[model samples]
Target: MATTNIWQKFKALIPEGSRTIVTITANNGNGTSQAQLRDGSVVTVKGESVQAGLKAFVQGGEIKGTALDLAQYEVEV
Candidate 1:
């Protein structure tokens, strides 16, 4: 006899919210601002008033807080 498992029926799950560091490009006003990712993608995130040309952490379409202005290094594998 063969046994069936229910867990195998589920596909690999991925988290909906992921945090990323971005630079504030512009302020949209009303407690929102536009940010640019490291790959040069611009996205609008909601959070406290932040000045443009600053780095901040964004998650779930919202800005969690500011991030350090450290140098970025990329590695190829």
Candidate 2:
């Protein structure tokens, strides 16, 4: 007899922290900065190296790296 580990299987499909594209809204002058998401909500991210008015990839509340300044579009289903 074998046990069906459904929980583990589902967990494996989920990522620890999905990366997101955000624009640097403001710099706190510290090691952290504020970023605005696609939904227009702002959140603090770890990293001030990237100046404002630029885009970056954030993951787990930290700045993973810089992202290309590309325009985004939304479509209706």
Candidate 3:
């Protein structure tokens, strides 16, 4: 799906300006992948993901744990 569509879906799952931690997993178009985001809560994107001004944010910088699949993520309050 397009980034906009994914972002819209994510927004519907969360509120605006809500403090949250997001984990993204980039799909390699393959079957095998890793899993993360043990928390079931949802989060919001804090910044843009691309130059097109996409409303997508990735989990990194300071947040430590494990890598997550870009396809699957969770928000933790």
Candidate 4:
């Protein structure tokens, strides 16, 4: 499914008129990808990914435990 569509569906699951803070983090293994959306809870996604802008990546591969800084990401609602 498209990312917008996924977020639209997920929006219904959250309470109305509220804001949610989430971190979209990706951890890739050889030949595959996995991601986590942390909003005080972790929702893992397989075979899908999050997009980060240039310079958003902090460090990777066990260097800093995150690919992007907290300010570089956006959660669509």
Over 4 Å off, model 4: 1-22, 30-38, 52-77
Write out the backbone clash pairs for model 4.
none
Candidate 1: where are CA atoms >4 Å away? 1-16
Which lDDT tens digits does candidate 1 get at residues 1-77? Answer: 98877666553364457889999999887788989998898888898556798899888989888898998698999
- Candidate 4, residues 1-77, lDDT tens digits: the string is 63467887888887544332334445455422333334344443332233422111112311222343545567899
Tens digit of per-residue lDDT, candidate 2, span 1-77: 99999999999999788899999999998899999998999999998878899999998999888899976798999
- TM-score against truth, every candidate: 0.70, 0.72, 0.19, 0.23
Name the TM-score of candidate 2.
0.72
User: Model 2, 44: alpha-carbon shift in Å?
Assistant: 0.7
lDDT of each: 0.83, 0.92, 0.35, 0.37
lDDT pick, better of 2 and 4 = 2
> What C-alpha lDDT does candidate 4 achieve relative to the native structure?
0.37
Alpha-carbon shift of residue 15 in model 4 (angstroms): 19
Model 4 — TM-score against the truth?
0.23
For model 4 the local lDDT of residue 64 reads: 21
TM-score-wise, the better of 1 and 2 is 2
Q: Model 1: number of clashes?
A: 0
